[model samples]
Target: MIKKLSKKLSVSLSKSLDGNNEDVEIWTYGLELLLNGTIKFGLIAGLSAILGTFKPTFLILITFAAFRCFGGGVHFSTYPRCLTFGVIKFLILGSISNVKGNMFNYNLLFYVTLFLGILTIIKWVPGDTEIKPIKNKEDRKKQKVKTTIVLILWIIIVQILIRLNSFKYILPITLGALTSFIFITPLGYWFITSIDNILDKTKVKYGEVK
Candidate 1:
């Protein structure tokens, strides 16, 4: 469906804008991204309404999506799994925040996890997928810089939300930050690879997948 829409848009752009194949390809790719984002966000919003965890879900989506976009960590190879994983992810975070409410673990576990996240970012970032692999030194450096800036900004935002000292903000924002941090780690990379492998098996069983 998305491909067809992109194709139609590309054809229209070609006629209206008098564009070439490269221009058409650019517009088609842009349309695919726009469509995919719309669907994903729509699903997220629908789930938020059903779960009654709007704020938390929104925060989780924002932080997680931001990291996943620039951090360039693990991503599901297929579109279906990506959507599934994203929904499951925000739902879990939102559910936990709703149930647990304002919680404090001002202990070593919190500090340890935060430190681990920092280490992971320093070591594994800016992570890229196999398809959108960052091959150029300049591009790689730029991505890394952006990743660092975003992570720092996220940390600052989380701290500010934490200071709010409200379950509504603190719990959701803190947990969302934690989840985002973990997703950029080697473990996240492992999980992505595992999912891809399982999808590979599924495709084989189905035979000649679309």
Candidate 2:
């Protein structure tokens, strides 16, 4: 049953990537992202479940997805890249927890992991070796401020969610976060990239390549 579902999902996603129908493509893209994210989070949740820390698993997944929606989406613009990062991050978190002998304090480890991940993202910023002028200085400043505000809001919400033991609402929260992150970040990138490739091929076939 799972395999059948996965096959159908793949076909649907491929059709969406074709980008012939805008509305249907957008909806399909959203579903693709959600499914991919859910699978990734499910893997982490399974690992946590094995270690008897299921609640934190769901919480961590939500927090990670929220952050990805805001930041990592622009940094790693590929579904495979995002999945790779997710797997690496989970391994690092698990290894550090093992070394510290504190599985219950996974939240602390998650924060540390996120901090390091942010630093990594910054290090990979485009044009790091070259200086570029802001095309619209005022607009750039406003965007920076907005991004900061959104980040602060996200942090506060995460804190409240943790305190309220929202992790206990595991399945739904996981699904929501997973769905949002997938569309807004990795899977969205994949959809765009696939369309670009198809367009490039079509242009070439018509002798319109530049």
Candidate 3:
């Protein structure tokens, strides 16, 4: 449904703007992202309201998305699978923040996440796609620098939150950063590919991947 809508909108807009085939493709991709983001985050916000995890969910979403923008991550083949699984994953992380108590040194966990995040950014950032590969070395370096800046800002934010006696906020940021970092790693690609294959089989069996 979203795919069709995006195509229709893209076609209409392209015609209105006297755009060619390339414009249509670009518009389609952009519209799909906008529509998918709206629907996915709308569902997440609604669920968070019911579960009383709005802040945590919002934090996780923001941090994950920031990292994802600069550090390209693996995407599911279909939007439906991405939306479904993405919501579940974020909701679970947000809900986990609700459980009170220190679980084995959050400071240690934060530093460890920071260390791994920096390493991942240096090694495999701009983990580009076939559609939008970062072919230029300069572009790849810029993306890595941007990702490192975001990681640093996230670390500072989490640390400040801790100092302000707002401990609950730390978990979601850490989880979000860690999860996004995984997507840039070889292991993360393997993990996502495995999940994608599983979902593909399931969709074939169920006839749901339109």
Candidate 4:
């Protein structure tokens, strides 16, 4: 549905603007990206409404954005797979964020998460994929350094939050850090590869690729 909508939008724009085929194709691709992103965000928002987890989910989104901005990660090959992975990821992070007071030590979790997250970033950071490789050495260096700084800043902020007894925020922040770290590892790249394989098999049986 999102793909069809995007295509229709691009076609409408092209006709109205008297665009050529190349221009229309570019517009179609951009519209697909816009629509796909909106649909995925909508899915998360709907889930939050049903689960009453808006705050935690929002925190998870913020933390995910912080590290992902510089750390980078695998991107799904197709929109459907991307949406599927995103929904699952946010669901788990949201669940973690909703854990009640004193069930587990939030402070301890924060410390552990910070350690692991920084270690992962330092060890295999600037992780790239076959389709979206980070090839420049200078670019790689900058990303790694920036990703490390983000993680460190996150730790400091979490510490301040803990001092303020903002226990509710700890879980989501820790989960976000962990998720971000995972993305900068080979595990994250393999996930995309796995998704690609699934898409390929389904396409083979259906005799078409979306």
List per-candidate RMSD values in Å. Answer: 2.4, 11.5, 1.9, 3.3
lDDT ranking from best candidate downward: 3, 4, 1, 2
TM-score between candidate 1 and the true structure? 0.87
Per-residue alpha-carbon lDDT of candidate 4 for residues 51-73, written as tens digits (9 for 90 to 100): 88878887888888788888888
lDDT of 2 by residue, 1-210 (tens): 333455566567667676345645455556666777787777777776787655544554555555443333333434555566565565444433333323255466336544544343343211111122334545444534543454456556656766786543332333333333333344445764565566568778886532
Cα-based lDDT at residue 145, candidate 2? 51
Summarize candidate 3's per-residue lDDT along 1-210 as a digit string, tens digits. 888999999999988999999999989999999999999999999999899999999998998999999999888777787889899999998998787767466877787888889889888898877667888999999999999899889978987998897888888888899889988888888987899888788889998762
Clash list (residue pairs), candidate 4: none
How well does candidate 4 match the true structure in TM-score terms?
Answer: 0.80
**Error in Å for residue 175 of model 1:** 2.7
Model 3 clash pairs are: none
Please give each candidate's TM-score: 0.87, 0.43, 0.91, 0.80
After superposition, candidate 1 runs with Cα above 4 Å error: 101-103, 106-113, 206-210
Clashes of each: 1, 0, 0, 0
- What local lDDT does model 4 show for residue 179? 82
Range of the 10 consecutive residues with the lowest summed lDDT in candidate 1: 101-110
RMSD of 1: 2.4
- Scored against the true structure, residue 120 in model 4 reaches a CA lDDT of 74
Model 2 C-alpha RMSD vs. true structure (Å) is 11.5
